[model samples]
Target: MPNLKIEESNSLISKAVIMTGEAPSAEAVPVSTTRTGQMMWKDTFYAGEPDIEAVFDVDTEAIQLYQSQASIKYGSIAAGYSVLYAAFLAMGLYGIASVCLVIAFVFGVLTRLTCKRATAAFNTGGIHMAITSSCVRYDQEKPMVSTAIAVQDITTCTVEQRELKPYCGLFGTNKTINLIHLRVANGSSSKRYVGVKDPRNFARLVMTIKNRPRSAAPPVASSEIVFR
Candidate 1:
């Protein structure tokens, strides 16, 4: 399969990366207008009817839109090692040259592998969320993006409006755009951004339900959901 990097990352398979500064903007949509859950609010991305209590919506920014940060760094490492290996081989240092070659190969593999699984979710690409009492489920459109968030893992959720030219340029305007920062208890570096119609209210909604205990709903399979 051809390895694909989401513009920011370097991909050996891709000769050049074309960047267009297009801010991803979409109006927040209701999961179900006719069928409302007591606690769960689901988009078409989720399957199975558990009457899962759906709550407020979260317009998510996919990790696939961000994780290319490491691609060029790894590619540079591989290239540096390959150059050192060539120099060593030319100087009759076969043992060291072989080791350098091995290191180069390892880094090369990592450069390729980093293009996949940028987020915890499986190829997710939706901007809206299917919310529950304790978790926020996202829709998947492309691969390597996040799919869900456990509310218990969250320590605090806050929105910071800033004017910036982000790496992906997925969401930002000439004026300050709302960037909701969801800090976790474990302090994991991996984070997903979200764009919503009203960021302050969205952040408030997340905090209000952040402490609710998760439901004992049956897990939904990816293949089972119908992607809209």
Candidate 2:
């Protein structure tokens, strides 16, 4: 009789279970923070979600400034007209009062819409934003559409800031808000980052990180412009 030997590898992985293995780790996750802000998340969890293979920056300050500005704008419209409406009514000018009421209502509606957009953009308690070489993404729990935008698809990220003014007119506030207007390809599609105080830094980060594909250079027109 002959004795046979069988040695165990003691590894968690089994030889028979070779087809499936541990997933590969994501690359280039820095241990330190960037100059702009702090990184909140380095990876994504939800399916079909953003592939943020970089740091997720959280703004130190809340974006409530945007909503405040909107409120001021709408409040002015509503308040100015509301006073007129009240005066017209008190003066027994019912028709004029009705017209002022309608105008106020219309302007109030615009304010509501602006607030809604701001909510999606960055009205959350804190802005969770991430920028990779491939795309840009943010945490918008109730976004109008997908929150991720491919780098190539992004045409420009410009700062939409209100200049400092000592006073305001009856229709609007002195300084409305500071936001980032993100214009994507086709120009029609867009996104907004509301109440971002440092809009220039935000825009610069996105523009610098994203690597847009360059078009092939055209041939020189005067290459064959000789007398031949």
Candidate 3:
């Protein structure tokens, strides 16, 4: 019998494996970072999700500011009435003091309700935001408000640092807060995400993922012909 030799084509087999596995690599996988923040009623005030893919906690300062503002607004109104009631009581006007007390009680109840609403907005910490390829979603328990907005719908995303002066710069220290403003396309309305750490980086990451070009199908491998 004539001598014969058989050889395996390793190159061809390896190439086939590489091609099939290469498709996943062609698709750009999103990178995500977790952020923590306090939840405001406005933050989790919306509903519905656009298929969430990632989640980030609301910034702590944002939630704190929101609660503080709510407290101030309702507290001040309640306090004003309370002061009036105290004054009337001190003047020994029984009938007028009774009326003022009723008024103060009403205002105090309203303030308490407002604070409860704020608390119900989220749990102890803050709201958790879900980030998808196209939109971002804000959700929380208790109040059950979830909001989703597409990236393309976003017209403007800005980070602003504002100095907060207490007592009109009289005797208190000033603080700065970072706020992220996102405006909807072709609309005058905008949403603000505040106290986000490294707001610029977060904004850039969102925009980069949003603007990234959609990947096309992977190319099929072709064999080259060789002759000796």
Candidate 4:
């Protein structure tokens, strides 16, 4: 049977298996309405109900929108300089035109390269559920840092504005998840404070997934923790 497994550092918590045959009817949950950004978790398996729910205020996502400064740098003014220099050179304005073209070419290449890096950094393409036992790996005998925060430590959560159709690029502060930065308690840590696009729905969905009955409780087979 396909089961939801959590890999961990400690053998005891290394691989906790959960029967996910009874998960919610939803095939895939829509994470962010702001489809503008790549889907965080595309196709992933998550344990059902009673999973930890952490809501941090710190927005972990590093989103990049078209900045005004960037616009100015690449705007009409810059284009005008290129045009004027090209025109001046055609009119026999010394070697100034050649220098202008070289500078433009160099900067253009640099701009393209910089944009590529920015795109890579902002690319979001995976689900980051709360850190599970598999992720902790107690067997390692060392503190673990996860890309996403653990749900168990989450005390309170709040969702702001569900109507903000983010997927459609509808702007205006529609929906937001405010979570507590877990790593903050430790002082200058590297743990990531990730965001769950739809905080309310995601929480409800997780609970449903984890809490689902495990095949009628296995018929109370033998009434023992282990059956040799």
lDDT of 1 by residue, 1-228 (tens): 232211111111111111112232353223332221212223344446453334333333333333344555677899999999999999999999999999999988887755553443233433445445556565545442445677556655555554433464445443334455666668875344544334443443444454333359432211110001
Least accurate 10 contiguous residues by lDDT in model 4:
219-228
Q: Candidate 3 lDDT, tens digit per residue, 1-228?
A: 232222212122111111111122332232222332111122322235444433343555445555556566667877887788788889898788788778777777877755654575446544555556677665656566567788657745666766654442344566666666777777777787656544544454355445544469342222111111
Q: Model 4, range 104-152, lDDT digits (tens) per residue?
A: 6665665554344334324443223443321211011012223433333
Q: Which sections of candidate 2 miss by over 4 Å? A: 1-50, 53-62, 86-99, 110-126, 132-135, 142-146, 160-178, 186-191, 195-201, 208-210, 214-228
Best-fitting candidate, measured by lDDT? 3
Instruction: Judge candidate 4 at residue 143 and give its lDDT.
Output: 25
**Candidate number with the higher TM-score (2 or 3):** 3
Which runs of model 3 end up more than 4 angstroms from their true locations?
1-54, 74-122, 165-172, 215-228
**How well does candidate 4 score on lDDT at residue 150?**
36
Q: Choose 1 or 3, whichever is better by TM-score.
A: 3
Candidate 2 local accuracy as lDDT? 0.51
